[model samples]
Target chain A: MARSLTKAYERVKNIDWEPSYISAADKYVEATRFYLPKKALDPFKTFIREYFLMEREKESRHYALLEAASRLQGSNPEPRWMEGMKFALSNLSAIEYSAGRQMGRMARVVAPMELRQGYMMQVLDEMRHTQLELNALRHHMRSWQDPSGYDIALKAAGNSVGAGIFRALAEDFSTCDAVETSLGLQVLIETAYSNIFFVGLSSAAAQSGDQVMASTMLTIQSDESRHMANGYATLMTLLQDDRNIPLIQEAFDKWSWRGHMGFEVGLSLFADYFVKHKTESAREMSQRWLLDDFYGGFYKKLAKYGIKEPRWLPDVIRNSEWASHTAAVYLFGAWPVFYHRYDPIDEREMEWFEKKYPGWYSHYGKFWEAYQQMTDADAGMLVTKELGGLPAFCQVCQLPWIFPRPDASTGSTIEREGRTIAFCSPACKSIFENDPNHYSGFKTFYDLYDGWDLADVIVDLGYVREDGKTLMAQPVLEPRRMWTVDDIRRCRYEVTSPLRKTAGVSAGGSPHSAVP
Target chain B: MSTEKMWIEERDIVGVKLIAGEEAEAAAAVISESYPDAVIERYPAYLSIEAPKEVVFDLRQISERLGRPYDAPTFLVIMSSYHGRINVDDDRITLSSEIVRPE
Candidate 1:
């Protein structure tokens, strides 16, 4: 007969004893503002031995699939999805590694035995997730026909301007209060946003013929339930003290917006734009997974404990209407700056988008038309230059000011210490206002490359393959002539900071005006 | 904008998303048998099973349906993700909308 898990867990709980030699403060190096109680729930009742055995089984199963994928070399994956993986996998692995570091920090500072035990397992889980993504990157690099983008993925993730969005998110979660990190990462991101990525997008991955990625996403998602439980356990432990309610509310308010802008926005972009054979729009996925499942199912229950809905949920819902289209504009417009081969959406997809979004074609049709025309390198046209240059990126979200829609942007600007700072939405502005110092230090894409030439910026980012002259990013997946450094230099487009031009401007300035 | 009350419907739906496979099919069969009200939605990559208020998965029943010896941890292997408060004992895993208080 099997041993009772409840009894085993109870016995395991007895093993913790206060150290006589070291004080609690000295023992736990970091301090969290959120109060943690002595007791917490570990619903999984995870034993380290069982955890390893379970994980080992999972790893063997996933790796066996990967191994088979490598040996069998099945159907050709969709080039659009394959190219997008260069950007997605790179940022994902970095985020996972940062999450692993956060777990270690949380295990140290959080006093509860159950939560800490869960955190310890999560630490390993995160590390495994990181390696799993890196392995996926390696697999794609080895197998994918055009390996230029894959070859430079990790480096590009560090240096590319678009990747700054993910970096800002990872850094924000990494540097915040340890317990707050739990709410932001585990409660909000892992629970709500990851479903869209792992379950929803993995379907897209399978449809796009990337079985390896589908397997990778599903396997990674298996670990997230435990992480969600970790967050729940921590939240429940914190709620025991009445003092923590307001603090919890504050954290929820901030992270809800932060997670949406920082994480969900990017995933939405991938879902709507990357997958060639689309199963669902980003809006539909958000409606189902985030709005219906997370907000409706989980968050409503939190009201019993005095936790209200996040302050920025309305804005989140509003932004969801056009977040993907705007993000698509940013990535597509500034193609040279990124590290992916572009696949512009066709008439079929545009019709699909219009059908799904109602007015998507009217708002975004002209841009796609111009993009298709400008794909020829011989034409000496760069779409980034033609679109009156890229707009100013929001300092808080690290996305461009033209979000939701370029024509009707909710983005605003504020002056702090005589310097102009832009925010994508009222939510972001409020987040920055909460802790000006925390966000004030972040440098935007324009900050780094305002005066540099377009060619030099790409060259400096090291977004080039082994043959250093050919650029990693192209206007289209397979261009008639690949736009090299020389080709970009011919365009003579210099990178200019939109914020610099619009300095001293008030809150309601049009993002479109700054484009030129 | 929709009202918060409208968004947060009174129905406390609890769900588990399992990776699409034989295990998911078997689990879905057991769940349908156990909880007649369970709604199983099939997607290309996974199976989404939702029930009103609560859903219980008995590993013994699942194993019987699968014609193999399945345990709780192995059951977790197929479960990609889930929402609602989760409780796992030796032989069963329960997903409930009930708020569990700390001891």
Candidate 2:
């Protein structure tokens, strides 16, 4: 009887291949084939490899939970990792909302039946990610309240140091054409930039002993790898014809820079500030994955295919040294919104900075030193005096106009219909120029605060307590808490000065390189 | 300044870290078969087996070494931390850094 059942299963394995029976060409168009003629495309003999792997993703959850349990081994949550986890959890809704909607949209417009089938799995994976992240959050929330204030945080929370990038990601999926969206969101964002989280950030999650964060990220990454491949397949299939070259190149320029905007901010802040230990600098990881591998290696391979480096490459490489440091200075002031206590850059970490990035201290250290001096004088005063005022805004990203070091950009702007629109750089201007209908006249964060004071703006954005004056500060639970002004001072003390925070485990390496 | 970069070059390399046992040996062997550059680092409890960019754990290869049937989902059980995205299916698994753009 079992043999008969196996025979029945095998009978359906051979799908109808005759072009007469609803040909893939007549009924379904290749997603990128609009740019390339059908003759230019490669024949897909079997289902794309990504489609098959996603089918297996259905079983990944069974193992993800067990793996989390194995790593936990009945210990309490590690406080620092938990803090980073909370920030990760708070930031989840933007991507979750985008992925869920985009995948469903993809099924409609995406031409090939197999490609659409793969996106169906991605839709499930994105929804699964939402649930898994919620589970991870719930596990951590058992010990403490969800510090994200995510429930109350504004829908357009791009009002601060970095959250804007997450907020902007929605449009790439929801509005862009199939080819553009796949190349941008799936290829550049999902495949390329995701390593910062899955490999680099996830490793930090593990080292900090938050198995739920680590395992959840790792499992989510399994889906990403396939979805990424699906995107890559589209690029390769389309690139087979030179007619599609310019179309793909344009996409490569725009998305690659935009993909890294929030990424530069979040990953930098996470690595430099939030981790239990400084295992790797954000700059070092960016240098490896972004420079040495992605551009130096993978993008180089594409040169033969006639694709140029992203238009923003030079500026990105220049800013790689400065992006995190630029962000860290501002983020320290915006700590409540970010949902983690800011440990003032410690002396050793500063030394780590100087060693890892030459002349980094000269470029950014004085700002840290000045902030430290201000905090030392009076922590309460530092918030009101220094961090007040609108640091300029970029028309495109809506993030603070932080670039070119030290002072904020005076900003280049175009005269438009009686008003001037300011931009952080020419690349942002060029990106804006490409689609003025969709992009231009969008309000920067500065525009949102037309008449309100900074504190009132924060209050309006739900960053205030019921009492009104108290900004809703999220506390780091251990390695010391952050309830009082003194605790804030103590957190700074832990990072810097004569008495520095010691590594709980060995500093040079982990007990097991595998686990590390 | 000695001028040697300190942070280990483990950023986007993909492989498995397994508790030392026959399973570890099986994993290491399968990895070595596919990638000549694969290396193993020994610690107190586990073996850190890795290949640059990615490591493939072909279910057929690993199962042949272990003398048992293995599913790709079982990677979660064996790996402690992997440095690249994980792609798995019935026959093969690729721990790929570049997301495997089809040639």
Candidate 3:
């Protein structure tokens, strides 16, 4: 009778649930409270001492759990050579687990019920992943005296921004805007992080030959791809809203710039960290995937919504295809800060670029030189001055700041409109011209017309209420969360760009080696 | 800083408008459960969502029960999703998505 009972129980437990699926949604959400701030006190106290005390205690508890998880027997004998596995496993566990929790917070704000449930499921899966990875790392952790720096709290601050942005979209932007920014923009971010950073980290771990990282990433990314489908689906829903058409149009123009800037930052960080150790590198793939997989894919999707591509889209596309522009941008901005920690640039880096495109090296090298002169000769004045009040708006976008450029015929320049319209290259001018109503007659461009006056324009536009003395501008004019013209201009000189040429462009120019 | 030192803070939330969807709300029900001391004040969709600190949701969950994708990534694309249809006027996250579901 006992044997018969045991056999029956085993048979019942063996059923696979994948094909005949059911969502364990509540289970997923409950599991997330393990890591996430189940109560508000946690996030608000992120900068406080009690949080540190709680973290230290929590760390100790987790360490004990880690030890308990390690001693259990596995499917095979514990080998002497598997010493490093524990450390890698623990780190991966923390990273992926935190990523899942962050996804949950983000999902609560934006994702519909089904998607939110899926994210919760992902959270549960990630917990299992952490446990498994820690088991893998246990052998490695035994040899090491301390394993402190791998805490997710430290990493979460940086990565949590993605989650934070997601939450903002759910809570802040319209459903249409929220869906576009959270789903579409995040797909780009996640795709890049999975490919560039996490994949590299996984490969660097010694026992990575099982290719477990790839398998795990592939699994998570399949979900991400599905999320992309949902993003497109929500976008279709948003597009059907007549009132939101202009908002969507306006958001596309704005967020595209924001997305590109973020992409550049991510690419630069990856190049500094991962590609540093290699003879031949993944630089080309890194550059291409960001533009092609992300930006290119994004633009194609947006076009289906009756939204035309931004004029500068082509230029951003053309620039990303070559390595030279990145060289210029990095040299002036991020590269210098990065090189302080790495090996000097090797001939191998340039050789790889040349191999990818025979003349890409020589052509861009010269362009860098010219860009350097342009930057040096026109440094201070061309960029807008930082001021207290909102700066002048662009004629076209009715936003602030444009790129500054030198006239080919004469060194003399024009600063006609209040906006400091600094063109990174000449190609952008036509983009500005194409939608003059949207762009022109911003406080700056309108001033150029002989008859128009700021006072009358402001009054007619109801800059002041019925009370004439009050300069109560439209709330739109009030500062809100935006990547303003000033922000763009700041990013221009501040971030490394490929257009500018100069060796010091990035500190200690040449592709920087990786951080150990 | 002590956990005791931290005070409950109030925040506003906002969203853009859409069609077929006359209005949307992003209120959190478990405010005390989540933030023990915090007191949340609710408002119309337009004024509150954009306030300094908030935890907002799409309210899309109420529309369906199963087989929906309501994760973080989908929410990020909300702006792009509503292009051409629901105009995000000055304050409100207007609902312009045609009301296929019955009120």
Model 2 pairs in collision: none
Residue A418 displacement (Å), model 2: 2.8
Tens digit per residue, CA lDDT, model 2, A381-425? 343134333344566765555554535342465656555565666
Model 1: per-residue Cα lDDT at residue A69: 93
List TM-score (chain A only) for every prediction.
Answer: 0.97, 0.78, 0.40
Candidate that would win on lDDT: 1
CAPRI quality of model 1: medium
Candidate 1, after superposition: displacement of residue A263 in Å? 0.7
Per-prediction DockQ, in order? 0.52, 0.17, 0.01
Q: What's candidate 2's DockQ score?
A: 0.17
Highest TM-score: give the candidate number. Answer: 1
User: Which window of ten consecutive residues has the lowest lDDT sum in model 3 chain A?
Assistant: A37-46
Output the lDDT of residue B69, model 2. Answer: 72
Mind giving the per-residue lDDT tens digits that candidate 3 earns over A121-207? 445545655554554344333433322212222232222212222222222222222334433344434443333433333233213
Query: Cα RMSD (Å) between model 3 and the true structure?
Result: 23.5
Where does model 2 sit among the CAPRI classes?
Answer: incorrect
